[model samples]
Target: MALTDTAIKKLKPSDKCTATRPDKYSDMNGLQLWVRYTGVKSWVVAYRYQGKQQNISLGLYPFISLADARNETTKIRNDLAQGINPKDERQKAKQKDNLDFDHFAQIWFEHQQTRIKPHTFKRDKGVYYNHIKPLLGDKDIYTVRLPDIMAVHDRLALQGKTSTAHKVIADIGRIYDHAIIKGLAPNLANPIPRGIHKSLVEHKSKHYPRIKITELPKLLTDIDTSNSEPLTKFGFYVLCYTFVRTKELLGMTWQELDFDNCLWNIPANRMKNGLPHVVPLAPPVIEILQTIKSWHLHDEFVFFSNRGKDNVLSSNAFTVALKRMGYKDKMTGHGFRGLASTSLYEMQYNPQAIELQLSHVQGSKTVRAYNSANLLPARIKMVNDWANVVNEVKQGDFSTYKAKSTADGNEMAFISFLQSLRYKEQEIQDELDIHRMERLEVLAG
Candidate 1:
C-alpha cells in the first residue's frame, strides 16, 4: 500500500507482535514500511525468490526515505514478476563490491610498481593521482565508456597536455585489464582501442635542436663568459664532452666518475639500453671533472643538488641556461648527441666507433649480439678528436673546417664537380673549343 501522511507520522510499534498501517494507507504490489514490536520502523519489499515468497529489507527509516523505499520496492517487484530472484542478483553484484575506476587504478598502480623502475613508477603514479583519478575515479569500472575517456583526452588537449592524455588513456586501459583479471569488473571493451589515439589526438614530432658545428665555439665561449650559475656551466661542459642523455648527465654521481683512469662509468640501470657504458675522458673533460671534484667535499654526486646531498642537479637547469644564452628554441641538452655524432662522422672517424662511443647498437642481427672489445681504443681516439675539434671551434678556429653534409659520395659529385671547375678552368675552355669547332663543321657540311 502507498504510504499516507498519517501512517508516516503516527507509525508506532504495538506490544507482543503485530503489523498494522493507518486507515488512510492503501497500496498494492510491494510491501510497505512498518514498525516492529520494538518500535524500530523499517521498509520491507514482498517478493518471490526462486518461486518462494520472501521479504527483502529495503532499509531503516530516515536512512531510506519514503520515496526511495517506494522506488526500490517497485524495482524488487518488477524483478520478481520477471521470474528473477532479486536477492540472488543483489548478492552477485555485492560479491564484486562495485569497484570503481579509481579503486581498481590503485590496484593497477601497485602491480605496475613492481614491474617498473622507481622513477618511472613515481611518474606514472603522479599522472594517475594528479590527473586521471580526479576525473574518472568514482565511475564504475564496467561503466566507463569511450566517450568518458575521450572527454578526458579533449580536456587534456585543451590544457596543452596531449602527450600526457595519450599516456593516461593507455594507463586507463591497463587499469581496466587489471579489473578484469582480478574479477573486480567484467571483461569489456577497452576505452582506448588500437588506432584510437590517432583519431582523438594530434601527433607531434619531438624536436631535437642541435648547435651548428661551426657555431659551437662561439656558443661555448659565450656560455663560459656568461654570469650563469656554476652548476649550469658545468652541466653545459658535461653535455658537450660526454654526449650522454640529459637525464643521465643530470643524475650523474661522483661514484660513476673514475678520475684516476679518466673514465665515466655510467651504470646499466641509468642507461636506456640497460647496459653499463664506459666513456673515455678528454683533457677538457678531465679539467671539468677536477673542477667539480674541488667543489665536492663529501657529496656522492658530481653534480650535487642545491637542496641537499641526497638529490642530484635539476633536469631543467641546462635548458634554462641555454634559454638564458638566447638559445631557448635553438638547442637542448639531448641535442649534444646529434652534434657529437655529426662532427665525429665529418672528421672521417669510423661510423661503428662513433656509434659505440655514443653507446648505440652497432648493427642488426648477429652483429648486434657480437660485442667487439677491439673498438675501445678507436673510440677513445674518436672521442678525444671530437673534443679537440669542439675546443678548436670554441676557440674561433674555423680554418680547414667545412660544414658537414648528410649526403653520400654520389650525392656530393655535383659539389665536387663545381669545386674542381675553379681549378680546371683552362682545361674546360680547351674542351669547349674542340666541341664548338666540331659543331661548326657539322653545320657547314
Candidate 2:
C-alpha cells in the first residue's frame, strides 16, 4: 500500500546491535519508508544503474519529508533517462574544487581577451552571462552532466533563440576545455555532447531581403528620407557606398581608418577569412566619414552605443530601422552586398576585381595570392565608379549608368573583352599595342 505523511509520521525503526533491520513500507514510486519501530525512521531508494542494482540512502525520515523523497526520486529517474548515474555524479561532486562554474568561466573569459577580437569576446561574454550562467553558474564542474547542457539548449530553442542555442554548444564546451587545460577537472568530461548542434532548431526564416538593380532608385530615396537615428541613416549610405558586411561597418573604429591614404583597413581578427582586408574609400565615402567624425559620437568606434563606449551599436540597429521604414521582410542590412555585386557585374567591371573587393575567398591558391593585393587599382576604380553610379541613380540619371563598352578599343575595355573570352584563366596572347599599354598604365596611375 502507498504510504502517506500520516503513516510516515507513524513509522518507527527497529534497532539492533550490528546489521540492524528496519520495517519497510513502499511509498510512492521508487521511494520506501524504513521504520526501526523505535520512533526512528529513514528513506532509501532502490534502482538499477549500469547493469547493477544499487540502493541509495535518501535521508532520515521526517527531516526528508515524503514530498521531498518523491521529488528526489523523480529527479534521479530523469537523470537516468539521460544516461546519467546520480551515484557517480555525487561521487564526482565530492572531488570537485571549491570554485563554482561561473567563477572558473569568468577566469577563462578574461584569459581569452588576448586571444580573440573585441567583438568576438563581447558576443561570447553575452552568451556566457545571459544563457549559460543562470542555469549552470553554481553547478560544480564535475557534477554538471549532459542533461544540464541540454536544458540550457532547450530553453534557448524554446524561446526562439535557435542561433543562440547553436552558439551555446561552443560557449559551454570551451569552459570544460579550459578546465581540462588548466588541470582543474582532469577526470571531468565535457557535459555537452559532441555533434549535439545538429539537433538544435535551424533558422528557417528568409535569410535576407534584397532589391533588384532596377529598384535601386527607390531604396536610395527612402534611405535619404528615413526618420531614423542619424548614424543609422548614414549606415545605409555607407552600406551602399562601401558594400562591406554590416558587422564590419558597425565595428569600424577611428584607428582602422587612414584618411590620408583613403583606406579602411580591417584587421585579420575582425575579418571573416582571417586575412586583413583593405577597402579603398570613394570621395562620397570620405565625405560620409567626415560627417560622422564631426558628430564626435565615440572615442574609439564610429557607431557608438548609448549604454557606454565599450558597448557598441546594436547589431539590429539597421534591421530595426528598416522595419520602421516599412521594409520589414522586404529589406535587410546585408542586402547591400547583393545590390552592389549585381550592379558591378552588370557594369562590366573586371569580375576578379569585383570579387576581390567583395572579400570573397578565391578557390585557386595561386589566383588568390595573385589577386589579394595585386587587384587594388582595379578595386579602387571599381569603388569610385560604383559610388558615382549610385550617386547618379539617386539623381535619376540613368543615361550615364552605361556598361563600359568593349567595342571602344580603350585599353581597359580591351582587357575586359579579352577576359570575357576565357572560359578559365589561361595563357593569353602576349602581343599588345605598345601605345595602348602605355596609355592604360597612365590611366591606371
Candidate 3:
C-alpha cells in the first residue's frame, strides 16, 4: 500500500529508550519515510545494484514530498537498470552548477588574450562584457538552448548591428565549442547555428575612387607644379611609386629605409593585415626620399609635421592638399593602390610579384611563406619598370612610353636621363630663390 500525506503526518515517533532504531514506512518499491526517536522525518531510497543492496538519501520530508520521493525512486530504479549509481549522478549535477556560462567565458577569454593582437583582444573583450554577458551570462552551460542564443542574435539584427551580431554569434560558438572539448558541457550542442549569418544583411566591400591610367600623367604633373609645400608634392610622388596605403607611408620613420639595398620594411603593427611588409624602392621613390632627407634630417619621421620634429604629418593633410589642387574625389590617398594594381596587371607584370609588392595576403600559410621568400627579385624588376613608365609622362606630351616587361629590364638608362634634367631644374629654382632674397634685401637698404 502507498502511504498518504495525512497518514504520514499523524504517525508519531517512539521514545528513545523504547525504540533505539528508526522506524520506516514504505510508500512503494524503494521509496520510504524514516522517522527517528527525536521525531525527525526524511525520505530515502533502497535499491539493488550489481547484486548489492544500496541506500541513498533523497531529502528531508515536506521538501521531498511523498509524491516527489516516489517520482525520484522511479528515476533511481531506471538508473540502476542502466548500471549507473543515482548518488554519483547527483554529485555530478552539483559540480556542473559551478561551470556556468559567465564563469567559463572569463576563463576562455583570458586564454585567448595571449594569442591575438592587443587591439583585437581588447575589442573582443569589450563585446563580451557589453553585449554577451548581459544576455546569456548566467545561463548554465549544459542548459543553454539554441533558441536562447537565437533570441540575442535576432535582437542585434533588429537593432541594425549586424556586424556585432555576427561576431557575437561566432564568439559564443567558440566558447561553447571549447567547453564541449574540455568535457565541461557534455550532451549540450553549441547553440549558435552555422547558417546564422544568412539571417543578417551582408556587409558590402568599399573601393576607393581613382583616376584612369590615361589621366594619371596629368594628375602627376599637377602635383609636381602645385603651389603647396614641396614636401607635400614629394608625398604624392611616393604614393604613386610605392603604391602603399596612406597610413603605412605617412607614419614611415627614417630607420625603416635601407637606401643601399633599396628596401623599406614596414613593421607589423602599422600594416593593415598585421604582418611586416617589404617594399622594393624604385628610382622614383629613392629620389623623393633623398630630397626629403636632405631637408629634414633631424626628424625621426620621414614626413615630419611643420609644427615640430617629434610629430608626424596629419592623415588628412594630403587629402586637403589634393582638394587645393582641384583633384577632389578624382583621386584619393588610397587610390594609388588600385591604380597601380590595375596598370601593372595591364602592363603584363607577374601577378604574384605585383601582389607581393602590394603586400596583399593570399594562399595558405605554408604557400604564402614560400611565395614571400622568392618574390624579391621579381618585385625589384617590376618596381623599376613601373617607375620608368611613369617617369616619361611629360606635362604637355600625352604620348605614353611602353615599358619593357622583362626580368632583366633596364630602368637605369631612363633613371640616368631623368637625373640630368632634374638637376638642371633644381639649379634654376635655387637661382630664382636667391635672386628674390637679394631684391628684398635691396629694398630694405
Candidate 4:
C-alpha cells in the first residue's frame, strides 16, 4: 500500500527487528518507506538495470517528506526506462573521492602556471613540492581532514618557518577550491580550515633586509659605477627613484609610459595587488627613462635582456646586481619600498599619499573600490621631493637629506637644515617669510 505522513508516523519498530518480513512500506515502482526495528525511518528505492536489481536510499525519514520521496521514486523509474542505473553512477563518483591529491594538485598547478605571475607560481610550486605534496600527496583529497592539515603546519612550524607554514596551508586551500570548481570533488569541503593558524604560533611576517636612508649615498655611488649591463645598472637607480616592486619595474613596457603627463600607468595584472596603479614620474626618473629609451635596444620592453630567450631581463636581475655591488644579504630589491615609505612619512607628507603611491591594499573593501588614484597631487609632489633627493645622492651629495628627528614641523629647524645643506641664511629667511605671508592670506580667505 502507498504511504501517507500520518500513517508513517504511527508505524512501530519491527518486533523481529526486520529479520522476519521486510519492515517497510512498499509504495510503488519498488520505492519503499523503511522503518528499522530501532525506529529509524528512511526512504529507499529498488530498481532493475541490465536485468540486475539494485537498491539506493533517497534520504532519511520525516526529512525526506512523502512528496519528496515520491519525486525521487519517479526519477528512479525514469532512469530504469532510460537504461541508466543510479547505483553504478554512484560508484563512479565515489571512485573520484579516492583520487590522489598529487594528481589533482598537478592539474591545479597547470591552470595556475598559465594564469598567475611566474614568480608567484614559482613560490607556490616550491611550497607544494617541498612541504605540502610530500605530506598530503599520497592521501585522497576527500580524506585530508584537519588533523592531516595540522600535521603539514606543525612540520614546518617545528623548523621555525611559521610564515611558510601559513603560505602552504593557503595554497592547499586554494588547490581544493580549484578541484571543486573543476567538478573533480563536487561534494567535498576544503580540508584546510579557516583561522586554524591563530591557536598556534602567531605568524610574524618577515621583512627583507634593509638599509637606512643614510646609506643611500654609498648605494647610489655603487649603482652608477657598477660593471653590470647598462639596463640593469640604470634599472637599479630607477628602482630606487620609483620604488615600485621589482617585478613591476622589470615587467614595464615602453607603451605604459606617458611622458607628456609624467605618469606611468601600471596595468592591473602586473601589480601584486591585482589593481591598476598610477606612478607619478619625477623629473629624475623621466631623465633616466629618456636615457634608457635612447638605447634603442628593444622596442617592446623598457628593460630587455641582451641574453635571454624571453627578450626581457630575468626576475633576479636586481638581486644579482645588488650582490655584485657588495650588498648581498644586506639590502634587497624590496628594501627600497620600506626605505621610501619610512623616509616619506618622516618627510611629513600625507600618509594616505604615501600608501597609495606604494600600491598597498588598505582600508575597507568599499573604500578601496572607489579609491583608484587617490591623492594624486599630493603623491606627485611627494615623489618629486623624493626624486630630488635621489638625484642629488646620485651626484654624490648627502648634505641635502634631513632625518625625521632633526626636522619635525619647525620652521626654524627646517631653516637650519637648509642652512646645513649650504643654503645662505638670508635666502632661507626670505623663502620662509614669503610662504608665511602666503599662509596668512590663505587663512584670511
Candidate 5:
C-alpha cells in the first residue's frame, strides 16, 4: 500500500515503516542521520545486518524534504535488491574517489616541497605544472597505465622537451607510490616503465663543460676591454680570484666582507653544504671588492645587477661577456672552478685545501660535521698567489712556466697553477672549519 501523510502521522513506535515510493527514497536507508522523540522529526533508516538490527540516520527534517528522503531511500533499496550492502558499498565508493590519481598527486606535491632543496623544488614544480599536471590531471588512478606515461614522454620528445618529460614521468610514479603507502590509492603498477626513456631519447650531461686549464689565460685575454660593462668585468675578475660558484659570488654582499680583516663570510643559506663558510680575502680579491665599492656603495650586494633593482646580478651576464669576448666554448662561469683547482694543485698546494675550497664533501661522517677548523692563513696565501698568476696571464706573462709531476703521479704543470691554488686553499679551509666545529661540540658537551 502506498504510504500516505495521514498514515505516516498515525505510525507508532516499533511499527515497521517503509515508503511505497521505495525506489524514490533509496538514499534515506543508506545514508546515516538523526531523529528526536520530542515530536521533532528527523530521517533515519533501520536495517538488519547478520541477524542484528542496525539503524542509520539520513538527515534532519525540513532540510531533507519528504521527496528527497524518498529518493535517497529508494536508491538504497535498489542496492539491497542487488545483494549489495549499501553501507559498505557507499564507503568503498568514497574511498575510491579519494584515491583518484589527481587527488593523491596534489597531496604528494605538498609533502615533497618540505623534503627537497628550494632550487630542486622549483624545478620539480615546473615539471609538475608544465608537463605532468596537463597530461594526467583528470585521469583516474586505475586508468593510467605505462602506455599513457610513454605517450607523455613521446609528446615531450616531439616538442623538444625530452628531459622535462622524463622527469615528470618519474615524479608521477613517485607520487603514486607515496599515495599507495598512505592508503590513499591502490598499489597497482608504476606507469613509468624502465628503459623506455633511455631507448626513446638520448641522455645529455647536465653540468657545464669543463675547459682546459692552459687555455684559460688566452680566453681571459680575448675578452673585450673596450665597451665592457663594469659589473660584467668585475664579475669575471671575482670568478678568477675566488673559486666559488656563480650564484654564491652573485649573492655576495658588502656586509659579508671585512676589508680590514681580509675575510668574506658567506652565510649558511647560500652555501651548498648549508654551513657558513669564511673566505680569506686575497689582496686581488680585496682590490676587486674595493674597486666595485668605489662605484656602487649605495647597493648592499658586492655584485649588483644593473638589470634588476635587487642585489643579485643576472646569471647570464658572465656567459654573455664570454660570448662577446669569443670564449663561448673555451670558458664558462663554472669552468673557472676547474681551471683554479687544476692550476693550484700543479703549484704543489695541499689537496685537502683544494677540495675544501671547491666545497666538495670529505668522505667521512666525522669529517662532515662542524668540528673542522678553517685553514685561513694557507687559503689566504693560495688565493693571493692565484690572483698574481691570473694578472700575469692576463698581461701575457707566462714565460717562466715549468711542468712538474705531483707525488700522486698526476701532472700539474701549467700557467693556470696559481688560479688552481686559490681554490685548493678554499677546499682545505672548509675541512679545517668542520674539524674545528666538531671540537667545539665536544667542549660544549
Candidate 6:
C-alpha cells in the first residue's frame, strides 16, 4: 500500500545508542521514502536496468514531496524500460562541471599555436590573457550564456577598447566552437552569437586615421621638408606612391623588383593575404627606389635597420617618422592606402582597376587570377594618374581650380562608369567623390 501524508507526518525515529540504520518504505513506480532511525528522511528510486538493480537519489522529504518523488520515480522507470541508466547520466553531467572556460581556452590556444604565424599566435595569447581569462575563466563553459559574455563585451566597449571587445567575442566563440568539436560542451550555445556586432554600437572603425584629400598637399610638403633621415623620407614617399601596407613597404628586397618592367612582385609568403601582389612603379616611385638602392648598396633589404645591416628596419620606424612629421594622429603608414583609394575613386578611375592596384581580393580564386591578368593595363594607367595627383599636391594647393557642376555632362559619366562597375547607387552617392562634386565642378570648369 502507498504511504499517506498523515502516515509520513506521524512517523518517528526509533532511538538507539548507535547511529540509526535507514528504513525503506516503497511506493508505486519504484519510489521509496527512506527514513533513518535518527529521524532524518529522504527520497530514492530503485530500479533494474539490463538485469542489474540501480538506485538514484531524488532529494530530501518535504522538499521533494510524495507526489514529486512519485513523479521522479515514474520518469526513472521509463528510463529503465528504455535501457537508460540514470546513474551514468548523472556522472556525465558531473564530468562536464569540471570543464570550465579557462581550461578549454588554454587547450584551444595550445592547439592553435602550431597552425598560425608566431606573431599572430603571440597577439592572440595577449588577447586571451588580458581580456578573456579574467572574467569567464573559472566559470563552467556550459553555464556561460549570451548575457554573461555580452557583459564583458560591453565593459570593454565602455572603456573605448572597441576593437579589443570585438576580438574577445571572436576568440571566445572560436574556443567554444573547438570545445563542441572535441565533445567538451556539446549542448552549450555560443554566448557570442554570429553578427553580434550589429547590436553593438558601431565605433567609427578607423584602423588608421587618414587626412582628407584637400589636406594632403600640406602633409606632403611637411614630409619633404622635414629634417628626418633621407632614407626615412624616401621610405615615406615610396609608401605614399606605392600605397602598399607598412610591412610590405618595409620588407622589400631588390630581387623582387623588375626595373625593366617597372613592377615589384611581393612573394606570397610576405603578403598578408597569402597571394603574390604586384605594385606598379610610377616614374616618381622609380626615382625613389633607385635612390634607396644606392643607399643600401649591398644590403638585401631596401630599408635596413640602423642597428645592423642584416636586420630590416623596425616596424615602428614609420610611426616614428609620422610623429616627427606631426601626423601621429592625423595619419599613419596604413593611412596612405585610404588616401590613394579615395582620391582614385573621386578621379573617376575604374573601381576594378583601383581595387587591383590596391591588391584587395576581388572574387573567387579563379576569378582573382583572371582579374589580375585582365586588370593590369588598366592598373598601369590608374597608377600613373594617381602619381600625377600626388605630384600636383607636391607642386601647390588648389586655389586655382574652378567650379562647373555639369562639366559638359562629364558628371553623368561618373554615374554611368561607377554603375557599370556594379557600385550600388547608395554606395556611389556615399563616396567622397560625389561629395566633392561641387569641387570637381569647379576643377572641370
Candidate 5 error regions (>4 Å) = 1-97, 158-162, 186-202, 207-213, 272-275, 309-311, 370-377, 399-445
- Candidate 6 regions off by >4 Å? 1-98, 191-195, 212-215, 307-310, 314-316, 326-328, 397-445
Candidate 3 clash pair list: none
Across 179-261, the per-residue lDDT of candidate 2 in tens digits comes to 88888766878777778767667644433567655567787788778787788888888998899998888889999999998
Better of 4 and 5 by TM-score: 5
Alpha carbon lDDT at 352, candidate 5: 63
Which regions of candidate 4 deviate over 4 angstroms? 1-134, 137-145, 158-161, 171-194, 364-366, 369-374, 394-400, 403-445
Clashes of each: 4, 8, 0, 0, 50, 5
34-55 in candidate 1: lDDT tens per residue? 5655445567777656667787
lDDT top scorer: 4
lDDT of 6 by residue, 145-195 (tens): 888888778889999989888888888899989888888766866767678
Q: For candidate 4, what is the TM-score?
A: 0.60
Cα lDDT of model 3 by residue, 1-445, tens digit: 7899988877767564223578888888888888866455678898877778888887556646788888899999888889898888878865765667887786687678667775577678778877888888888877888787767777887888877877888899999887778776567678676786777566433446777666776788788788867777787788888899888888899899999999998998889888889999998799889989988545688988856322666667778888888888878988888677655654566777877787877788787778888989898988887777677643433233333232222223323322333435454354335434433332333
Query: How would you encode candidate 5's per-residue C-alpha lDDT over 359-419 as one tens digit per residue?
Result: 6666575674432365556777778777777787666554322322233312333222333
Clashing pairs in 6: 402-442, 403-441, 403-442, 404-441, 404-442
Query: How far does residue 253 in candidate 4 sit from its true spot (Å)?
Result: 0.4
Q: After superposition, which runs of candidate 3 have C-alpha atoms over 4 Å from their true positions?
A: 1-100, 137-162, 221-230, 297-299, 306-310, 323-330, 364-366, 394-445
Better of 1 and 4 by TM-score: 1
- Once fitted onto the true fold, the runs of candidate 1 whose alpha carbons sit more than 4 angstroms away are 1-97, 181-187, 272-274, 305-311, 359-369, 372-374, 399-445
How do all models score by TM-score? 0.63, 0.56, 0.60, 0.60, 0.63, 0.65
Q: After superposition, how far is residue 403 of candidate 1 from its true place, in Å?
A: 10
